[model samples]
Target: MPDLNPQTVAALLPATCRKVFVAYSGGLDSTVLLDLCVGLPAFAGKIVAVYVDHGLQAESAGWGEHCRRQAERLGVDFELLTVDARASNGESPEAAAREARYRALRQLLAVDDVILLAQHREDQMETLLLQLFRGAGVSGLAGMPIASAFGRGQLLRPLLEVAKVDIQRYAQTHGLHWVEDPSNQSSDFDRNYLRNEILPVLKQRWPALDKTVARSAKHCGDAAQMIEAWAEQTLPTVFDPTDGSFNIADLSAITATQLNCLLRYWLRRMGLKPPSQAVLQTLVEQLVCGRCDATAQVCIQGSIIRKYREKLYCIPEQCLQKEVQTNPWIQEQERIILSNGYVLSRSIASAGLSKNLWNNAEVTVEPRRGGEKLKLPGRAGHHFLKKLYQEAGVPPWERDIRPLIYLDGRLAAVAGLWVAEWAWLSEADGCYQLDWRASESM
Candidate 1:
């Protein structure tokens, strides 16, 4: 009976949203949804259909063309994006395709743009069951929300509560045509197997299975929101903004279940996926009970939760790789980009390295090599790089990746942190400052 309620859809969308982008695949759900959007007076002359081609199937290109033709028939704008959805290490092909599709869509959207996806009650029920089997917490059991923040924009699922049979009826009444993906029939994929072999059997046993499961999901969502509110109130008391790490000792005061909830809520707020139960337990054990000097790390699908110096940090696994590069300095070059995507720039300043000295030296930049030493401007003698990093409060993981600027075979500066005593200009000589900007990916 829901059948993509326009009143409910209107309430979910922002008043300022004039443009609507439908993630259309020329499939039944999307085709029906697109037709509904095209009929809405509020979205007149402002609807577009976007089809992403993952290039996994041989017929993907033909499907994209079909979607384009369908959009044209509906008198709406259309776009097709092609992406290589090849799975990386430790990533499944389905995950790769989904991520790639979202990434592509995100690039096409502006900050205020809204994208609509067509996933119905059956889809929601299946998601809940999948999360339950994986031993997920309240958040996962809640399934998908009606609306959520997408990359730099927003996403709306107007059909989330609508029944699949109602959508099929709408399509049939409208005399609509749509593509049927062959992959959906395969039992190799987990979702496909559940849809074909599991859900039907369950439905036979409980005729009202979809409605009851959806009701339970709604209850879980309400509880998850409460937990999120609690996390927002508690995070400030235990988080240290100065160094961007959590206070492990303070966190240890709470029960393990409370700790898990707090951690999952915090991670979700930060736009990062929380680790699985087993992985999160290991991480918490390392943080709450491990020795002060001991370092521990738990790698999840694409991220790593690390414990160091009695504080916890979450870093992407890709960032842990050593990205080192050496490049000869040019006098006129304003900025140098490192292998890790960090940017280093030279600027004239009142108090920095001597401009004349630097100009005369054969300058180069490289990542930190062991056994390096630097003399502070006010310190008595040169100190080991390891000791300097510790004194400066730099994490051990960041030390080796930071840039080292050398002037005529001697270390002149350590990024923007410090300039060597020998490189300090006299009162008469002009000075120059080095500015380093970390990668936006971090």
Candidate 2:
């Protein structure tokens, strides 16, 4: 008896939203969502139906055409986005497809553009059940949020409180036509299996299965938010934003439960998925309690958590690659983006390399090679880069990867760390500062 009408849907939308994008798949749920959005007077002329074609099915192109036609008939704009959804080794096809689809959708969002999804109460119940089966934590058990940040915009599930039966009723009452996806009927997918087989049996006995499960998920969501808030407050105390690392001593002072929450929150803040509980336990044990000199590291997906110099650093796997490649830097260029995801940029400063010398000389950037030496401006003589790095407390992993700036085949600067004595400029001299910017994944 739940109403799936325009007024109810409109109440869920943000007042400051600039545009509404319906994730149309030419399916029943999305079709009903599109219809509701189109019926809203405030959303008129501001609606776009975005059809993401994963190209997993032979009929995908045809489905895109059907969605375009439907949007056109409804007087809404339509966009077709195609993506590669091929699964990697040991990866789930459904997960790959979803990742690809959302990646494409995220790229299409402009600032303040709200994207609407059609996942209803039943879908939320299914998500909670699946997460529980996997022994997930509070955050995973929370299922999908009604609204969250997506790209530069917001993603909303206005129908999250409505039942799937109500959505079907609305579609039927409006005489809406939608394309049937053949894959939804197949039991090969776990979600489909749950929806077609397990859920029906469970719902028959519970009757209010969706409502009850959704209520539980909401409670879990509230608890997860509280934990996240605690983590946010504690992060600045132990985390070093300058180097993207955590102090081992400070981390050891907190309780084990607090540490776990902080680690998960840190990973989420970096846009990386948190590892399984066992993996997280291993990460903490090895990285924190292991031998000081021993190389302790844990890898999850393509990111690595490593311990070095009493600090814990989360870096991309690619950053550990040791390739000695030299890149020429043209005099006119202000920035050089490296293959390792680091950026070397130049800016005007009072005390750096002399601008006149830099402009006339040949410049090249390379990763550290052994036995490199540089003399500090105020120091007596040339010192080995190794000794300088040790004195400056630079980590071993960073030493090999930090940009080494050369001028006329001589090491002139160690990128933001030190400028060679010969190249150092006085305050009166016009200078250009060289900076090393680490990638977000680092």
lDDT of every model, 2 decimals: 0.83, 0.88
lDDT of 1 by residue, 1-442 (tens): 5444456467666878757889999999999889888877777787889999999999999999999999999899999899889999988787899999999988877877899999989999999999999898888999999999887789999988888898898899889999999999998888899999999999999988888899999999999999888888988776766544666766556877888777776666444777677777777676657766435666665666666666776665655666566788898898987766667898778888889888899999987779999998988988999999998777788787778889998999998889999898655438888987555665
Residue-wise C-alpha lDDT for candidate 2, range 1-442, written one tens digit per residue = 4467887679888877889999999999999999999999877889999999998899999999999999999999999999999999998999999999999999988998999999999999999999999999899999999999999998999999999889888888999999999999999998999999999999889999999999999999999999888889998887888877877775547898898888887777666887789988898888877776536688887888888878888888787765488899998799987887877899998999988888889999978879998999988988999999999988888888888988999889999899999999976549988898666556
Q: Go through the candidates in order and give the clash count of each.
A: 0, 0
Q: Candidate 1 — which pairs collide?
A: none
TM-scores for all candidates: the values are 0.86, 0.94
Top candidate when judged by TM-score against the true structure: 2
* Candidate 1 runs further than 4 Å off: 1-8, 57-62, 86-93, 241-243, 265-272, 294-296, 300-307, 315-326, 366-373, 425-430
* Cα RMSD of predicted structure 2: 2.0
- Give the worst 10-residue stretch by lDDT in candidate 2: 288-297
